[model samples]
Target: MSDSTQLARQVVQALLDAGVREAVLAPGSRNAPLSFALLAADRAGALRLHTRIDERSAGFLALGLARTSGRPVAVSCTSGTAVANLAPAALEAHHEHLPWIAVTADRPLRLRGTSANQTTEQVGLLPRAEVLDLAAGDEVDVPVGALLAARGPVHLNVQFDEPLTPVDDWVPRPTTARPPAPASTPEPKVLARGPRTVVVAGDGAGPAARLLAEQAGWPLLAEPSSGARAGSHAVPAYRVLLGTELAAEVERVVVAGHPTLSRPVARLLGREDVEVVDLAPDDRWQPRPFPVVDSAPVWRVGDGAPDLEWLDRWREAGRSLAARVRALLRAEGDVTPHEVAGVVAGAVGARDLLFVGPSNPVRDLDLMMTPPPVDRSARVVANRGLAGIDGVVSSAIGAALAHGAEGRTIALMGDVTFLHDQGGLVLGPHEPRPNLTLVVVNDDGGSIFSLLEQGGADHAHAFERLFGTPHGVDLAALCAATRTPHWRVESVAELEHALSQPAGGIEVVEVRVRRDNRREIDERVRNLRP
Candidate 1:
């Protein structure tokens, strides 16, 4: 009926046109007009709208929903502090390669930063965010359509020119035309099909996993965070398919997503007959041999026929693997590796956890932590999607905030992974979270690199200088400044004690593993394997 109403309707329509099927909104006065418009759209079945009270939690909730749906979900909030609260999740989406969209109702161009009730400069809050400012407009917006063209996350800041209202002659239209979002340019695919090709999904796996498997007709294996659910796609319960009776059958394998959720399984895939392919997010293409693939699209179309029998077999295999690992850990009686794993696994709650994947830490956890004798309880997590040690800290923090403190959150990372994003630990502190833990397996060097053929090479100096960056960072000092509690443990007993203690606020457990000693233990474990 009015210009403001028409503009509001167009803005909402623009979001829907940009693949924003899901919207999470927080109620407020300044944003009432935008809120009403979105609610009307939701009621009309034009979009799925979720309402939450806390803007910070609401922002993360939108992130989690986007993660589940494999689409760029939007979070709508009122002006001033509400917009400020979204910084945490936005920061996470940026670092973890998640395409998230946010619509914030702002104060008019004049009242900004003055003594206004709910008004602040929300425009440049997230500089890294791909911001699209839509000042109340009529006619179609093409740039909004282009914003959805890319696969990553974005922010759509809606600046209403005061007195918000509904659009004139509004009629709801159903969305029918669904076009194939372009796949990230594929990197040269490596690892030819062998006798048995196993596709492994580590932590934070998206829907693209199923598509890739269907295209290649390869058997899929997924870790917890790889986002491969138990009922759909590959039997995500295939953690048992590695390092046991079924190990020989897997002649070749592709490692998609993260491998940290099931470290034992990742190690099994790293064996002589296996070739690991790292798929980062569904966007950005970069494929390397056992390196990260950033360009693979993660949309969930053509995943697979529900292979119940296939999943059953993996479930059986997982049962056996769990038993074996438990027995071995019991026999060892809190060995160094086992203790380290206990500290991590024990500290984490049933919520979400992010595991940082490097050669040494991931491999050690694979050989240690005994999977529970019963059904899987705590979901083991890792960034096996394109498993690079970079951004591990940021990813875990994002996952924690994504799940929020109501659920427990923990991150198991190496010293190197922690060092990579040490600065990220204190990012956007205004959006505080209580349920977060950081576990660093400090061995002082790139021990995983040492396990490779490069260890014995004469270029020890060069390799150490390049890969094994051992900058001695004081964990205690960093924790003190950041308000994250820091604990140092040299023995298994101390580690157990630290793990048993409850985590208040954020906790960083620094477990010191001697590099030489870790190498010796790993060598012995390899000798013990068949």
Candidate 2:
């Protein structure tokens, strides 16, 4: 067999041994050998193969698979701009600590700086990831094994010579599995019981924060993607409360994960009067501008029960705010973005998986998603690292495929976000389709900006053209073009009905609302008092 063919097979076998069950590939001439190897592996039932015409979508699809599966996922593409297209997904994976392996095909060393057809500096294309530059005859076992052992994303740039095709009937050998890494000891820090503390859980915090809060009888301010948002102590209207006088009374804050959603939370952490304790894992820590009094892997409050009165106070305030907000939403008469988010949250059961897009949809979910009841929990995911509104559709599709065969997958996004990665909806006839329901809140444009400073009356002159950027493409027609099922709902009841149906394949349910009331609604919400 040719050197390139042998190297490709070895690399694929190594990935399989590393426990990569899903692989996504983007087509190009340079990566033909790797493509053939991946197909062969799929035929052997070693891994599942997904093919995408767009490298960007393919990268996110792989990211989604890894995110939901809690296992490394491999994504391969040709050289040049195709490798660059994976940058967004790579950055996200690195920040979120997801296991993603990027395999890029490149020309041999002889083609360096020689005006090759699809050549660029592919070695350092993804600076955040550990890049492994390989040639045809180089040993692949060590580098591939190292990448598999690493926690985050890794890039493998392989150089192939003129003949990119594999030799006929070359079968890969069975891979040897490596022993699992040793688990780390949990060093729990003892927190002082005197101070009134609240647990702040951000993206990727998992359930540790929630468990700590429940045990300590402390209020939990968890972002929607935290997975710790449920439970009795979770404060639903934390954003508003953070801006209230009650937040001023906070004596200490225990933080987990990375909180980037609200300015109020940032301000709260910045307060010199309130001490902050961060319980982020060792590998995840980075220096921050805000002061953190203590940092550890786990934190345990000192003996004795926490002040139940303080917890009750915050819980009561949260309940009052939730009731007022619900009344206000009902008073609106027509369906609003907040209502749409609430209905979607209600529809999500313990077995369901939800991927929320960035911007207003995620923020709305943060504000409105009711805490799941006891004996039930839903896995909520969002790409909050850098938090850009790209690749969300493909990411959602990937999450759906990896989540399970029984549970339903739902994606909540705004019109602009949906349009940003509309290519995600395009699936080949032979490709695997997941049971996904995309809930799109269509307000004719970028309504999220309308709630920001850009929507002020003073900037109304430049608002519509610059920020709104309305693309009046009928979403139903867009769904039709992609051959996906589409539904348009205008009321809360209709949205609930739409979500109630079993999701068989990819589909879109568009919820229409007006953008004019966004600023007013936001002001009212922020100014609300218990």
Candidate 3:
């Protein structure tokens, strides 16, 4: 057997042994050996194979698969630009702490500085990820094991010579070695119950934040993607509340995960009067502008709970604010972004998974999504790491595939975001398609910028051309071209009905709305009261 083939087989075997169930491949000549090995592994029923022509899409697809499955996933591509394309997804994996194995094929070391056509510095290409350089004869077990242990994005730049083909079929052996036990986290810190505190659960804060809030009788200001945003303590109108007088009364804030969504929360953290206690999993503090009074692995309540009156005050104001916002939403004659987000959130079941796109859709969800019943909460995932709108469609597909047949997966993205990675829709007929329903809010342009300072009267002259980069691509035609089902929903009822139907294979449901009223709607929301 060829050395390249042997090395590829060994690496694939190591990955499978380390419990990698899914892998994505971007075709190239130098990576042929690895591709063959991956195919063999797929045929052996050891792993599933996903193929994408675009390396960027492939990387994000692997990211989504790993994010949902809670298992490591591998993404392999050829040398130079192909490997470089995986950087955005790799960076997201690094910040989100999702386990991803980046396997890049490289020319042998001798070709490093010798004018190789498809060669560049591929070893440390992903600065945030742990890098492992492998030659034909290098031991594969250690690096693979280390990647499994790190539980984040890891790079394996495997150098292959000419003859990149497998001579014999290789079957992977199941790993007998048990995964190492997770390190014991410190007990939740017992906080004094005297202060008027609220739990701020951000990004991957999970359910621990909700439990802490419920136990302490404090309100939970959880971001839409926080996973802890279902319980009664979860304040639905948190952003609005943060802008109100209620936020000014806050004496202390308990933070979990990284809060990067709203300026109000950032301002609250920056206040010298407010005592901040952070419960970040890692040593790095999230609220950098202000000093954290206490930083710990987890936080527990003391024997006493916070004043019930204080909790009641926040809850009452939040309930009132939410009612007003809903009233305003009801006044809108046609379907709006807020209504679309609400319908999407309401349609998702406990067993379902929703991948929210980065831009406006996620923010709309944050503002308007009715908190689901605690027992029936759907899992919400977002690319909040870098929060870029790239590869959202592919990510959603990957999440759906990882979720399998039992659960449905929905991706909520704006028209601009959907257009950004439309390449994700280009799946071959032979590839395994997921049960994904993509709900796109078609605003015709970048409406998100309209709500920002860029859309102010001062910048109105240059707004449409510069910030609002409108594309006139027909989404239905795009879906038709890809052979995916497409539905255009005009009303909330139509959207709800579309979401209620049995979802199988890939499909697109476009919700069209106007970009002109976005600024007005945002203003009305901010000005709303009980």
Candidate 4:
């Protein structure tokens, strides 16, 4: 073994010892010495390594691992472009506030800045990060200390001195012990109370996410991505659902880890009487009502805290939508997004739902279907992270891969999102096949725009040009092109039949909803209070 090999092993061992167990690796020769060493360690039961060829994908893969395992996860890449590719993931982590160890391979200081093949100034690249940058020549203790002390992600640029591998029989020193501390429990900091407070759960949240909101002792305002019922337009406190009149007496507002909205919600926090608290990782957007309650692991508020009763109430409220959805599906008897989601909710042994977003589909589902029946067992995931029209397909694919292992994956996305990354559909036929039922609400135009303020104004022409950006794509043909069986439903009966049958491969159901009637459907649904 050589010095480089020894250094890599020591680093890996230190991270594992420090409770960083998962590693997502991207291949590269500059980091070959470390990569091989880490791989060998994994074989030896000293670590766990998940390999991805694309650094971009690998970075997100690492994030998914960390998100699921609830532990800081690390990513390794060989030098050069691979390191740069990790930036998107790093940016996401910075925003999502996930801890990912970005390990980049570098040449010795002498070789860098001389146009060395894989050498560039890799130091302090993530200027916005709460990082502990380390050099390969530095003592193992340095990276170890950084890893142990990291409140968030760190970047480690390793410069392996020539001779790449370290001699065998060398042992890395253990991390130094910390000083003893006072044993008294610190009181939690609580925000000012409100006469009526609502906890907003963003995308990627599950029951655990909702549980956090409940802990704050406030009604939950769930986005489609956040995975909760917006509730009946009538119910007051519980109905703090969409468009509910906010209270003048409410003092504080809390936003959990979800993406910011494209359209603004109530201006309660904007009022002089209200204060806003964001529990997200980064405050870069400087979200309005902008104080941050920076809690670790998860954020909690107040003395009695968010109670189980709130979560239970939320669950029951969700089931109300589910029941209505089921009843509609049973009555309509169709394979539309509504009927399919209805059948899925009934068949679902669990509450885990993977919603795919795009212009037409999610909105249609929102208007037509009730929430899934198994609310407590349900979780909703959407890539509203950036709310881009681009990644809906890939994001859905990723979510299915993440959660489909234990529960059913019912993907409700628009034809555009489906067509956007239909390549992701390839994963379905692979061994250990993903259990995903993709429901593509095939509205020809960009339907979501019609509901926005932008939709009703003179921007109509601009809307068609920018927001609508309609592409005359045929989803049924595309589904067949992928060898995935598809159903074309024009009404409720067809949709019900498509959803009622047992599905083996990835299934795509295209339901044609006219853009003209969307507003009417939305108004009817919103007016239908239980």
**Ten-residue segment with the worst summed lDDT in candidate 3?**
281-290
TM per candidate comes to 0.54, 0.97, 0.97, 0.68
- Model 2 misplacement above 4 A: 175-179, 281-285
Of candidate 4, the 10-residue stretch with the lowest lDDT total is: 232-241
- Model 2, TM vs. native: 0.97
Query: Of 2 and 4, which scores higher on lDDT?
Result: 2
lDDT of each: 0.60, 0.88, 0.88, 0.57
Error of 3 at 431 (Å): 1.3
Candidate 2 positional error at 36, Å: 0.2
Worst 10 residues of 2 by lDDT: 280-289
**Model 1 worst lDDT window (10 residues):** 292-301
Write down the lDDT that model 1 would get: 0.60
lDDT, candidate 4, 1-530, per-residue tens = 56677667766776676666667677777787777767776666555666666676666656655544445777898777777777766766665556667887877778878998877777766544554444554455645555655544678777777676545543333433332243554454555443345565455443444554545556655555555443321112122233323243455556665534423334543556655666544453444344443443345455544444544554455446545534543553333344444444444445355554645454443433343333344555544544555544544544555564676767777766666556555532322345667777776767776667777767766877777767888777777776877877787666667766748556777777655555544444444333
Per-model tally of clashing residue pairs:
28, 0, 0, 22
Over 400-488, each residue of candidate 3 has an lDDT whose tens digit, in order, gives 99999777889999999899899999999899998899999999999989989999999999999999888888999999998889999
